[model samples]
Target: MGSDNSTLSSDVITLNHGVQQYFIPSCEKNRKIKIIATPNPSKGLVNINFENWDDIELSLSVFDALGKLILNTKLNTRNTQLNLSDLSSGIYIISIDNHCGGASSFKLILNSN
Candidate 1:
């Protein structure tokens, strides 16, 4: 048997055979929202920036290396600052969600000293 496939759009794909199958790529929309965290190894203070935000409601979350949630808050601006001076020095995971269909995660290092 032979099969053929075609892309319906940048976000969708279709396959043709005796039976038709549709496949949708994951995270296509999420990729559009660019996230940036400055000073990977920071001294308790960090700056976060977003691109293509389009004024969509977004939330910021921080988790410890052990998978414990350290912080969670709704973002009110395209650029925001995070204060992690209270936390110990180590690696942390920073996550951002647009609350629509886009989400991203980043790694942040905090140096208490």
Candidate 2:
């Protein structure tokens, strides 16, 4: 991703009524941003989150080992949840479509129980 994960400050949050929603910007490559990868060895559930300006839309897609499309989701809300309990044991790629042809990806190693 071109966008630096640094642009995503940990302090920017959105609250409605009494709920607090944290917004993070997508790491765009051309933008020179790096996104952090997590859960190194994730289990049944995995979460892909980003932070940035208040008004940015990002799309996230998941692909499997066979280079097959698995899950495709959009995040205009702030945060989204991805369920990996049903996926097979292997490494998967979560692609975050940021901007200007730049996309950020995270590698997930899942061990099925």
Candidate 3:
């Protein structure tokens, strides 16, 4: 898995953001992965959806305003969902990482009743 086979695969191309490197894992080359949040402004509860993937290992987490992980879990398939009704009212960041090679970060704002 450590070998560089990208040069041999016509469909594989390297992608990067500034100084960060992005690549599709060798094990999940044919799969797709995505993450999303609903009700940008969340109140007692929230629904997070991780969509589209043939085979992936995903992680979803909620962080407090200070960037501390208060809730987290691992998901390994499509249409994964997360419930965030136990978190206290405040601004939180939701991070989804396909440990295989994809990741996305977003914010969730929680308000009091």
Candidate 4:
């Protein structure tokens, strides 16, 4: 629930562009959180790194281009590698949410060959 006075904005940028954006709640504007998913053009295996802030639980979710959720799980560690061998080769979106705070998303690719 955002107020009409909230002028905050969220933008999606390409990974190569070197600019990253996250969805910040109006109340947590002063906090810093970073979510990184590596090996973007990966071969079915990828690693997601949650940087800064730890010892807390978080969630990672994967969705297909059709906006359908494929996988969702809670992460107890700061870093975790996801195996998508069961999924077909395609493009998908991975979203990370620090249940206690912020959230962000990034694109991912899976190649079966």
How much does each candidate deviate from the true structure in C-alpha RMSD? 12.7, 10.6, 11.7, 9.4
Q: Which consecutive 10 residues in model 1 have the weakest lDDT in total?
A: 17-26
Global lDDT of each model?
A: 0.67, 0.59, 0.57, 0.69
The digit string of per-residue lDDT tens for model 4 on 39-90 reads: 7678888876655545567778999999999999998886789999789889
User: What are the runs in model 4 whose C-alpha is more than 4 Å off?
Assistant: 1-29
lDDT of 4 at 88: 89
Q: In candidate 3, residue 59 scores what lDDT?
A: 71
Clashes of each: 0, 19, 0, 0
Alpha-carbon lDDT of model 4? 0.69
**Residue range 11-96, candidate 2, lDDT tens digits:** 43333332223333434433333334345466757654444533356677889988799988776654456788898889987777
Superposed model 2: Cα runs more than 4 Å off:
1-34
Model 1, 85-105: lDDT tens digits are 899999998877765655567
Task: Tell me the lDDT of model 3 at 50.
Answer: 46
lDDT of 4 at 47: 72
Best-performing candidate as measured by lDDT:
4
